[model samples]
Target: MPLVRIDLNQGRTAAQLREIADAVQEVMLDVFAAPPGDRYQIVTEHPAGQVIAEGSGLGIERSDALVMIQVFHQGRSVEQKTRAYAGLSRILAERAGLAPGDLIVSMVENTKEDWSFAGGRAQFLTGEL
Candidate 1:
């Protein structure tokens, strides 16, 4: 289970946002192997200057289209993470017209105990997942 958070500069149309989010979901499914229909994402649009992402000496530049994606989920292997990153970069460019430099992705790993699907219960821990 991966809970994705997409933060982007406020300018894109609704269709653009949907395309970007769907592209990410595709990567999560194809690369991360998330279960079917387990899609969970939160997309937040911020005004200009709200999201400041600068290249850390990589000589890369970011524009208003910068999209920051954070995935919180159970531990995934390094290979999976690498594939996910590459897939996101490639697929977003193809499907959403997002520049590779304008994208930032990060992953946080946790145990099943960290999740609570609904009803105030830790579904994964209670065998409800």
Candidate 2:
């Protein structure tokens, strides 16, 4: 399971936020092969001054529409991660009207033992996943 956190400048409507979240989930499903209903996402909107996103020498210009996505999950193959990035960029552009440059994504990998979905047990290790 992947837990995603979406951070953006505070402005868009709830529907727009929902669309962004849904698009991310779709990418996870397609690229990561995450099961349906395994969605774990959080959307946080920050004030203009509170959110600062720069290109970091990439020569890319970002706007207030910046979206930062952080995904925490088990390690994935480089190919899978690349595909997810492409899918996210494409889907966000089509569904949320976000430019590719306005998006930033990062992933944190952990072992299956790092997660305890319920009963204070590691579901994956227990073969309950």
What CA RMSD would candidate 2 show? 0.9
- Candidate 2, residue 18: Cα displacement in angstroms equals 0.4
* Native-referenced Cα lDDT, model 2: 0.92
Cα lDDT tens digits, model 2, 78-115, are: 99999999999999999999997899999999988898
- TM-score of every prediction relative to native: 0.95, 0.96
Question: What is the C-alpha lDDT profile of model 1 across 1-129, one tens digit per residue?
Answer: 799999998998999999999999999999999878889999999988999989999998898889999999897899999999999999999998888799999999999999887789998888888
Decoy 2 TM-score against native: 0.96
Error of 1 at 126 (Å): 2.2
Worst lDDT 10-window in candidate 1: 116-125
The alpha-carbon lDDT assigned to residue 29 of candidate 2 equals 90
Q: Give stretches of model 1 more than 4 Å off.
A: none
- Please list the C-alpha lDDT of all candidates, in the order they appear: 0.92, 0.92
